[model samples]
Target chain A: MNKMAGSSMGEDTIGAIQEGIRNSAARMLESGEIDVFIGYEDGTLPLRTTPVFITCPEDAERLVWSPICENSLTCYLPKFQGTVGVVVKGCDVRTLVNLILENQVSRDKVKIVGVPCKGIIDRDRVGKALGTDRIIRSAKATRRSLMLEGDGFEVEMEIQDVLAPSCEVCRYPVPVLFDVLVGNESMARDGKDPEAGYLEVAQFAELEPDARFSFFAQEIERCIQCYACRQACPLCYCPECFVDRQSPKWISRWRGLSDKILFHLGRVLHVAGRCVDCGACRRACPVGIDLRLLTKNMEKAAKDLFDYESGLDIGGVPLLATYRREDPDDFIL
Target chain B: MLKMAKTDLDAFVDALVKASYVVLGPIQEGEATKFGVVGGEEIKIPRLTTRPLKELFFPQDESLLSFDRSGTPDASVDTSGVLASDGISPRVALGVRPCDARALVLLDNVFASDDYRDPYYTLRREKTVIITFACPLPGVACFCESTGGGPYDETGSDILFVEVAGSYLVKAVSEKGKGLLQEVFPPCILHEADDEDIQAAAEARARGELPANAGVPIEAAAAILGHVDAFGDSAWEEVYKKCLGCAVCTYLCPTCHCFDIGDEVTGASGERIRNWDSCMFPLFTLHASGHNPRPSRKERFRQRVMHKFNYFVENNDCMACVGCGRCVENCPVNLDIRQVLTTFARRELA
Candidate 1:
C-alpha cells in the first residue's frame, strides 16, 4: 500500500483548531448535548477528506481540520432527529445558517463548531497542474505550497495557485454563526473583495445571448444526469425533486440535450437565492462540469436585484418566498 | 509475446484505423479522461479513465423501439433500426485497465446470461476487441487484488499490453486479438519478446500488485452479508449516514449494470428507452402501487452493498464489484466501500 501523508501551511493553527473541535465534540457527546458530531476525517486518497460522523465521545478524536475539509456537513443536518454537533468552515456555516433559515433544520437542534478557514485546495487544478494523466501517489502541502509525488515525477505548486475558485473570492473566512469558535477568529485570513467574487459572472454576462446559450448547452451536454450537484447542495433538501417526480415528470431519463438543460436550469432556479457558493456541487461532479457559471449568476442576480444574500440571518425570509412593494416589478410585465 | 517499441504506438493505432477498426482509447475530454474514439489524438492511458469503459458497450441511455400512433398499432411498432447492426462496425478498445476488463466479464454474466440475452450488449461485445494495459503502479484507491482481480489480471482482455523497459510486451489473450495482431504487425514488423523484456514485465506486475495487508476481508464480509439477519444489522445505520444519495459511484462503477426502462411519448409518436439506474437513487425501487421496499437511503444503501457483495455472489458465484476504486475516489462524502466491507467483516452476525 502506498503511504499517504499531508501537512498544511499554518500547521500549528490547523492543529489547534482540530484539537479544539475534538475536545468540544467529546465534551458535548459525553454530556448528551448532541447525539452525533459531524466533521471530516482523512480520506483514502491524497488531496481528499471525507465527512466523518462521531456518535461516541471516544470517536471525536478522529475529527480533523485541513484545507481539504471542503464538505458542508449541513447537508446531513435534516436527516438527524436529535441534536447534531457539526464542524463548519466559514462557507459551510453559511449553509448551516441557510438550513436554519429555511426550517429544514432547527437552529436549536444543531450545535455549530466553526473553524476560520483559509481556503480549500482544488483537486482539479492540482491535477491539471501535474498533467491530468499523472497518477498522484502522494501529496504534501505546506503553508504556501503543495508537493505532489508520483512514480517518476514530482511537482510543487503554490497553495494560492490551486485554491478552489469559490475560496479565492470568499467574503467570509470566519463563520458568521457558531455556538463554539475554534481558533482565534482574528487569525482567519482576511476575506477577499465582495465585488471581485462576481468578476467571472460579469464577464460571462457580457457574452451575447446566443453565445451564452451555446456555452451552457455545451456544458450541460456532458451531464450524465447523476444529480450529484443537487445531492451535494445543502439547500436542495426537497423531499422529492421535480426531476424525480413521476406524475409531473419534469425531465425524462433520456440523455437528451433539452432534458439536461431543463434539469440544470431548474436546479439553478430552485436554489437561486439559497445557494451559498460553497463549491460542493462542482466538487461532487464526477465529470467536472463548470456548474458555477449558472449558480453564481443566480447568486449575483439575487444580490444585485434584491440586495439579498443567503445564510446571513436566521430570521431572514427566503428570496423567492417573500415579495415587497419596493421589489422590481418591470420584469413582471 | 510480441514486442512493440513505445514510439510505434501511433503507427499501430493508424494500422487499426486503416483496417476499418474504430479504435477507442483513453482520451482527455476537457477535465476528465474517458474512453472515446481516438482519431489522431494522443492516447495517454491514465491509471483509469474518470468514466468507466462500460459506456462504450452499454450506453447510459439507449432506445429500444419506436412507435407511431397514426399507423395501425401492430404495424406502427418499429424496432428494426434501434441499435441495429447495419451501422455497427468492428472496434478496438485500447488502454482498458485489468479491473475494468474484469468488470466486463461480470457484466457479461448479467447481459449475456444463459437464461436471457440482451442483443444490444451482445452485439457490442462481439464487435469490440479489448486491449488491456497492465498497471505498473496501483493508485491509492485501487483494491482489485482484494476482489479476486489484480493489476495484471487479464481475465476479459482480448490482448494484454505489459509495459516493459522502453517498450510493451503484447500478449494475445484471445483468438480475435491474435488475428488482429497478425494483420496489424505481421511477422516482419512484430519482434519476438526477449527474456529481459519478459523479466521486466514480471517485475512491473509484481510492483503493481497490492500488498497482502492492504486488502479488506471481502470474502468474509460476503459470507456474513449472505445471512438474512445481516439486513437488519445496526452497523448499516452508521455506514449509510454519509452517503449523499448521489449516483456518482454507481454511474462510474464498471460492474454496476442495473437499468430502468421508460417510454418517452410525443404527440403521435413514442420511443421506448432504457437508462442506467442506480440503487443510490430514491426512486429506483419505487413500486407502481406506491410501495417502496427500500424506502430510505439506509435501505437503498444496504441494497447497493447487498446486491454487489452478497446477492451477486450467490447468483453468479462472484461478487458484482470489480474493486476499481471509482466509488472510493469520487464519493463526495468519502464513504469508502472497503471500510463498509471491513465493518461487516468484523460484525457479529445475528
Candidate 2:
C-alpha cells in the first residue's frame, strides 16, 4: 500500500489517503484532544497543495492530502497556541521536533499523527524531465518503482531516475521521534544506489579551484535577497533577522555577486549545523539558485567533523552549544 | 612549542593537505565580506563577513530528509528509528572574532535547553572549536559594550589571539582551547592587563567611528524593553516600509532560530524535515485557517524588538544579542536594526 518506486497507483489512491485523513481528523476533533486539526487540502492549481486547519467537524471535510502537498506545514506551530493536532509526514515531523526544541510549542500542546515518507517528486522537475508542457497528472510510488503520467507521455520512470536533490542523500528514511506512525515502515536502503545524487557533491569537489568559485559566484549572483528560502525554512526560527541594519550595511542593496555571496554565506552560517536538507529553499526560489549546494557543503562538513545530522534525534544539543577541549582546531594560530 | 617564526598564517595553511578546518572569515565576494568556508587558501581577516557567525549552527535552509518519492515504507521507514551517529563531524572555525564568540553564547540558551535540545546544533557545538581574533578596531556597525559584551570578551571562544604589534598574543579561555593549544604555543601567563594595551585598543575603537555614528546614544536594552508599549506607533511602518517580506534579517542574525517542518515521501517511506523560518514573513504568524496575527510591518517590527530586548532578557537574563551589528550592516534597503533599537529607546521610550 506504500507509494514506492515504479508502482502505478493512480489518483484513486490519492483520494483514499485524503479520505482517510479527513475521517481520522473528524473523529479526533470529536474526541477533543485537539482544538484544531492542521493538515493539507487540494488546491485550485493542478497538483498544488495548500495548508488547512479544520476547527469544526464540518470543516474537517475540506481536508485533503495529495502528492502536491509540497509545503512543510509546520510554519504555523509557533503562532498557533492551545492544543492542536497535526498531520505529519516523516519530514514534517522535524518541524514538530524543532518547535519543541525552541520551546515555541509544548510537547503536550500538539498531537502529531505521523506518516512514513517514501520520497516526493519535484513537480517542476517532473515537467522538466518529461521535456513537455504537459503537467504530471498524478504519480504512484512503491518500493523500487515509480509510475508517473504526464500530458502525453505515459512513461513509468524509475523513482531513482527523477528523485529530487534533497531525497538523494536522505539518511533518515524514518522519523527520529514521533507520537504516531502510519502504514508500514520503509525497508532500509537495500544497499545504496549509486544514482542517489552523491555525484552532485563529487561534482562540487571535482571542479578546479577557480571553477568552484565561479560555480558559487554563479549561484550567489542570482540571489535577489528575497529571503524566500529563509522564510520557507523550518530551521530559521528567529523572530528578527540581521540583514536589516542601517548603522552599517553588511550586505549591499545592489545586486552584485559580492552582496549575493555575502547574503548566501551569512544565511548558510546562521544555519550551518542545523540545516535539515529540506528542498524548500530551492523550491521557494523564484530565481532558481541552487542554495542546496551551500547547505550540502555544510551538511558534508557537519557529518565529517561533528558526526551529526538535523532532525534525526530528539534529545541532542546543537553542535556549538557544547565545546570539547579536544574538538578540532587544526588551523588556529 | 611548534614555532612558526617565518611560516606565518599563509605558510601555516600551506602545511595542511587543505587546511583541515573550513576557514570561514571575511571574503570580498561582492560588496561584502560574508563568511564562507574557504575554497582554497585565502587570507581574509579583520574584514566583516557581511553577516555574523550565527549561521554556523542555526542555518537558514536545512533538510531533515531526502523526499525520495521512491522508497517502500514499512513500519521501519518512519523517523523515530533514526540514529544520532549518522552525520556531522568535528571542525575548527578559523577566523572567529571576539564578538562572534559572544554571539554563540547568546544562542546557547535555546540550543542547550534541558526540556528539548536542538540535536543539529548540539552536534556542531560539541565538535567545533573557535579561535577568536581580537578586533583591531571597532567597525562602524559595532556596539558590543552597550549590549553587555566587548570586543575582547572570551565568553564563547576556545582560544583568543590578540594582535599585539608583530605577534599575536594568544590566550585560552576554555579547557578545550587550553588542551588544544598546549603544544601549539608557549604557555601564556595570566596577568593584570597593562593599561597601555587597554588604552591602545580603546583608541583604535574611537578612531574608527563614522561621523554619522560618531556618538550613537546608548542605553540598557532592558530600559528599552520597559518602553515596548511606549514605542507603540507608526515608527515601525516608516522604518519597515521598504521590507519585501523577505527573511534576510533573521537569516543573518546571530541569535534568531525560528523554523518550520516539512514531510515528504514516495511510496511508503518518507522523512520529515525542518528548515529555518522567520517572523518577518506574513506566513510566519499566519494561522493554518488563514488568519495572521502579526498582519503588518508595525506588529511584526515591534515583535522583533520585544523579543530581542524584552522577552529574551526577561526569560534568559541575557539580551539574545551580542552587538556584532550584522543586521545593521546587511539590510538591502538600509533598514538598520541598531537605529531602530536606539530610536525606539530615544523617541518612543523617552
| All DockQ scores | 0.74, 0.05
After superposition on all C-alphas, the RMSD of every candidate to the true structure, in Å, is 2.0, 23.3
| DockQ-based class of model 2 | incorrect
For model 2, state the Cα shift of residue B257 in Å. Answer: 1.5
User: Which residue segments of model 1 deviate by more than 4 Å?
Assistant: A1-11, A140-143, A152-156, B73-75, B85-87, B186-189, B210-214
Which residue runs of candidate 2 sit more than 4 Å off their true CA positions? A1-217, A220-225, A228-333, B1-7, B11-32, B65-87, B183-221, B231-238, B347-350
The candidate 1 chain A region of ten consecutive residues with least summed lDDT is: A1-10
lDDT tens digits, residue span B22-71, model 1: 99998876577788889686567788999999998899998888888876
**Candidate 1 local Cα displacement, residue A234, angstroms:** 0.5
lDDT of 2 by residue, A1-333 (tens): 012221123444444455656767887789898888887654323334456668888887777654445666665577666888887765667656766766777888887766555555565566567763343455554444456664355766665766666765665645556555544354223223423434577677888989999878866775646676776776776765665443354644432468678778888888777777767777666446788888877766766667766565567667756588877777344
Tens digit per residue, CA lDDT, model 2, B1-350: 11122126554334321435444555554333455665456565743454567666755444444434344352444332332433254456657877778888878888877766777777777777787876665554567766766666678998776665544455677898776555343323233346665555456545433232323344543575666455566556555543435666676677877776755334655566555667776656777676778887667777777788878877888777777766654443334566667666566444
lDDT of each residue in A230-254, candidate 1, tens digit only = 9999888998899999997788879
Q: What is the C-alpha local distance difference test score of candidate 2?
A: 0.61
